[model samples]
Target: MAPPATQFELAQPPNDAISALAFSPDSPSRLLASSWDKNVYLYDTLRNSEEGAHGTLLRTFEHRAPVLDVCFGRDGNEAFSAGMDWQVRRIDLESGEQTTLSKHAAPVRRVVYSKEHSLLISASWDSTLHVHDPTNPSLGPLAIPLPGKPHAIAASPSKLVVAMTSRLVHIYDLSALSASLSSHPDQQQQQPPQPWQQRESSLKFLTRAVAAMPSDAGYATSSIEGRVAVEWFDASAESQARKYAFKCHRTAQPQTDGGGSTATTDVVYPVNALAFHPVHGSTFASGGGDATVALWDAEAKRRMKVYQKFADSVAALAFSPDGRYLAVGVCPGFETGMEDYSGEGRTKIFVRELGENEALPKGKGK
Candidate 1:
């Protein structure tokens, strides 16, 4: 049997459309959202303890324009936001202090940080990714060009990966990335004229190519094309090798639900946001436009359970560190399009546990 869809609405932002969202990685119950209303909100998931009391609103701040994305920085208490105004800003969750990093040439689409490196990455419509140090915004950004318009970006603290409109992913080594920036003229004064700075540097492309994941990976990408494919290149290799891999694994079925009948003929969905249990890396959840959240055996590429029937496209998904809960943001009836995002939106938290029937039909562990 499938897992029951247990949900709880967290909070409703006063925005007509919520375009970007994030839950605290360190504390999955805490949430931050940005919307067309030009405001940013922070909410706690467990605030509704008493019927008479509401969840705590850590803080809310108005932006100058429609904010595109909001994300946690290296620290859980600090958030970063980018938007239509072509600017990126950082907010301190505890003090509610906002700081503008720098103005982009185009609207900002995404902002991410690598806590281990104290680095922040932002992508913009201008087809550039700016690498910045969140602790200090006064420094210039190390601008990296993209093959096409970047729709989404993800990183693992030390590396940067981006999905571009051309169905490709650009992988840049953070160490090399930081080295490239150090060679910039602005950084020359601090480096004392290094010999490498005198040599002409060129734009280096990854030896390997990664495919774009359509929808279901999260709110940042679309899946109308059938599936989003990603390929990664190992920069450490002498030949710059590439590897083809599925970022999200979806079982295909024939058109069902009046769409089809064969399991082999249907398209595979893309993965939207991914949440690995803070304590258990092998367990994670993926939410998407299909209105279904799936629990996967991340390391083994196996499906453990499916949680379905969400009101709308999933905006965000997270797993608590204790591996006991799942949280998701849903925008009901809005999957048809984002134009009607204001209809009804809600955040739900589900209590999850390992199924007891792990008893396999033919296995020694069983």
Candidate 2:
């Protein structure tokens, strides 16, 4: 069969503006999305029924305020959501039960689960990060203050990284988190199951970087108008917390009206949402507002491929666990008639197959 015009347009949302999206870990063929309609929707991307071609909406959960972000835990069993309601809630896929947490000063922008499956970290316009142990909902004062309102969060089992509107990303050392959690006299023995030991850190390092980054390279962030960034810190760095400074758009500005602002051109488009390839070290994808999805060769600091036909800003993106597919959440018509949905537009999830030797058209004959 001839190669299709596009990889695949798996699903289109019910409403025009979709705000948040996630692909199920247990079953990648499934997806979850939230929208400006104050509702959460799930879809089976692989489903082919007479009802429609876009797939079916499995369930819809309503929020008092619009649902801005949605994320699935390690498996597909549960999902965490945060939105304009200033709240973070977890929904059990099987039970369909919802649990609400504290309110943020501003909109809760994102939610992610740490590796242990015990804690959920949320970033909000509130300028603070809340770490919650869903197992113990009554615990309080678990908030971590940030220099500015945070807009995104990424977490592994032992580390939590947050991206702020200030164009900085903060890394929290979770190796000692268990120690902190066990501080209470009555909870001394109830420590978290695993710690971020050097072994774990080394494993995370070997798995993430194609080549190991410098030990003193330090963990800082790169951003455009300080919108979002990715950072990595050496756990061995002194003043671990304060040593969280890495890099940025040394010279860039905010293009006010899309006149190809020097700032927009200078930024290489910092990664909006980051994810490791299910298979390769030093292989990752960065999705952002550039209307381009860039694949990176981390070790070589090289560009592998850029998918530029999205026609809008990209909000949520992911690599399938097996690394065979790339899913991007983008608003329709962003360049001409489409406005950025910020996870809130008529977004569609496009599944592109990897390893296409001819991803780009060749320059007529050699």
Candidate 3:
């Protein structure tokens, strides 16, 4: 259990808007954040949680171009990054050696590794997924085509969820992906594995982020519009009927016309990030252009906690392995009619150590 509501801001944060944040499954104190500034940052969460503590910057991995996402490999000693440079690279956390795993046709947006399956998967704007088994580098990666460019991808114990443009969502079985790589070379070359299930997104807008439930029951997806939908992997009609979507990260603002009359307008901000608690499977969190982070209970459909506003739009979020800490990445959000964007001076990362009962579902929603 963590101290009550004890939170601190990390020092030496990314110089650009954060693309993603990930915590090491093997080490609760290890954290990683990828940024548009062509770098991936490593931080020590335990050091930053102390009283009067600013975050501890552990190491920096510089890339040729902006890194879109990062994730822990099989252990805390390794990491993988997806890049705007159209490359997927693996980093040795100890020696800081970077190795190019594969180059995609377009920018790579997300990378997720499934330790259970020994697979490293990267989703790219090229509308394809490059699957690699880090343990067996000689076999090479297998490329699987997609219906749309993937924007976000995540891995559960048994499944892979890829959320893409035009409201496309695809779920792939990790075991199948693993088997394809280890099978005879001719079979893999003749045919690539297909998604186990493909479904149109429940949300109408472009999908922004996706997170797989630790329980492997389903996943939650957020969109450019301020909305989130939860769906289970079970294809049964009864299970599918339980799927739901909700509105969040929006505010009602009074609009003033040049003529002087004022009217209330609903301002909807993009839901930029979503993270599920590892300890409490039914509880998850979302951050948005509203610069706020909210916790919700999926089973109960209730709002649990809403942290105070950050300095800017919340770009990325991750729950620590034990679910005791939540890391939030903040930067200026790109709004309608904006001509320029930069997170250089304003980028920040906030880590909150939750109380034992803070994120636990309290009961059914009212």
Clashes of each: 26, 18, 0
List candidate 2 segments past 4 Å from native: 1-6, 12-16, 51-54, 165-167, 182-222, 225-231, 235-271, 332-346, 356-366
After aligning candidate 1 to the native by TM-score, how far in Å is the CA of 206 from where it should be?
Answer: 19
lDDT of each: 0.58, 0.57, 0.90
**84-124 per-residue lDDT for model 3 (tens digits):** 89999999988999999999999998899998888899999
State how far residue 187 of model 1 sits from its true place (Å): 5.4
Q: After superposing candidate 3, which stretches have Cα over 4 Å from the reference?
A: 1-3, 48-53, 256-263, 336-338, 364-366
Error of 2 at 118 (Å): 2.4
Q: What are the per-residue Cα lDDT tens digits for candidate 2 across 145-170? A: 67766655555545665555433445
Number of the top-ranking candidate, with lDDT as the measure = 3
Off by over 4 Å in 1: 1-7, 25-28, 49-54, 182-222, 226-271, 321-324, 332-366
Ranking by TM-score: 3, 1, 2
- lDDT-based ranking, best first? 3, 1, 2
For residue 317, give model 2's deviation from the true position in Å.
0.7
Residue 276, model 1: lDDT of 53
Worst 10 residues of 3 by lDDT: 46-55
